[model samples]
Target: MIATSVEQLLNNLEGTVQVKADRVSVIDSRSLQLKVDSIVYNAVFAEGLVRDTARWLLWELGQQLGIYPSSIHEFYMAAGRGELPKSCTVPAINVRAMNFNTSRAVFRAANELSVGALIFEIARSEMGYTDQRPTEYVSSILGAAIKEGFRGPLFIQGDHFQVSAKGFAADPGAEVNAVKDLITESISAGFYNIDIDTSTLVDLSFDSLDDQQRNNYRVCADITRFVRQIEPEGITISLGGEIGEVGGHNSTVPELHAFMRGYNYKIGDLQG
Candidate 1:
């Protein structure tokens, strides 16, 4: 989508501006309750300001600062008393972010100290997601990785956030609520993608007359609809429905297709 050559589009944020957390002073000279001097810029890729200007920033950063989140994942967060979108720069995707290796080489040459002109690609580290620890692991990794990159494109993935037996055993509704909270925090942390894996709850034993499995299936369908209904625009977020085992050895193509068709999702649904 960039009109100019990739070589000429490396921008560095470190040189143009500096970020000082201690200098975070919320100015409110207005007589009103809120700060009347609020000004939101379109620089989504800037260090601290929350905006939806990633691609242009990516172009500018690559042209100026030299690094950007690879996926353009739109960000989300819960501020004050409500759930809100913090930044819309990053986009969302349906497929797993790690699946990029299937299309291109996972490794790329890095020049962390080139100091001026350079290039880079999406460098992702798994956020250590098991059923135990939550979103912070991945958020920390993403933040660190973004700082590690010299230029071009650098990004972090929220990987997969799902319902775990351990988390849910405490309470079914609690697991859902916790997952939502994690998602909110991760989006605020500047992760490019949020993979909501509800596949674990689906009842594969639907062939049987099990009520529990049937309930689980309903939950998966419900969650799928929720994601499609609420995800931010241009944020490449993917809601992977439970269409049989995604990592099983015995699931055949026909079975997978049938499972997907049953849920109204196609066999070869292509999403970026």
Candidate 2:
């Protein structure tokens, strides 16, 4: 059953967990796990401040339990340097609905399989229709981790942070700022892996491949710089850029080279 208020939620977790002076203490690990399931449910389904409080408590509990949201940047860098075996592809799951329960199941399966390189992601469009901001989304994922006894770094991602072509055409500054605002929010809420999709700005009317991807790479580079400037000191945010829109023409090798060259030139000495 979902608790209606923070007090009710605390009462429900009486023996399992304790909250005092803004600190959460786990009285019973096994029981707290079960109670966390309901906490996460309330975080996702409860209304108004109840939902907000639930999310806050869940985040606090997750911190105390050592379940931290982290980036996959270093791991990928290691892979790039050939330091790790290329045995499997990391799965990026988009949880549009049932954010808590679905994430719990994913965590449980990952725990059973000893998998660690899984990601929970949501797109900007998904965030709007689903009514899930970055904070709630991160809480849901972390709450699930706590419920399932999953430990270590949790990779939460902002997927397809795309710019709309029509909006960009009408008001380029507003459109870009919208994406930048979302990026700031997502990064603040523990989404260290961000995929910037400026492919919508790609102008195929241009003859040369570099010209075609000029706007795409330029805006992507701008966003990349913004991300680097605002990212947390110790953590390097993993970023991805798109050269072509999905369902459009497949990107050629030359197009990929063109995008990379332009992007690299744009972000001169910036390190991801």
In order, candidate lDDTs are 0.37, 0.89
RMSD of 2: 1.5
Q: Tell me each candidate's RMSD, in Å, in order.
A: 15.4, 1.5
Q: Model 1: residues >4 Å from true position, as ranges?
A: 1-66, 70-149, 166-170, 208-217, 224-233, 241-249, 265-272
TM-score of each: 0.44, 0.95
| Per-residue lDDT of model 2, residues 13-120, tens digit only | 888888887788788878888778788778878888878878888877788888888899999989999888878578999998988889989999999999979899
Candidate 2 positional error at 77, Å: 0.4
Error of 1 at 144 (Å): 5.8
lDDT winner among the candidates?
A: 2
Please report the TM-score between candidate 1 and the true structure. 0.44
Candidate 2 to truth, TM: 0.95
Candidate 1 global Cα RMSD? 15.4
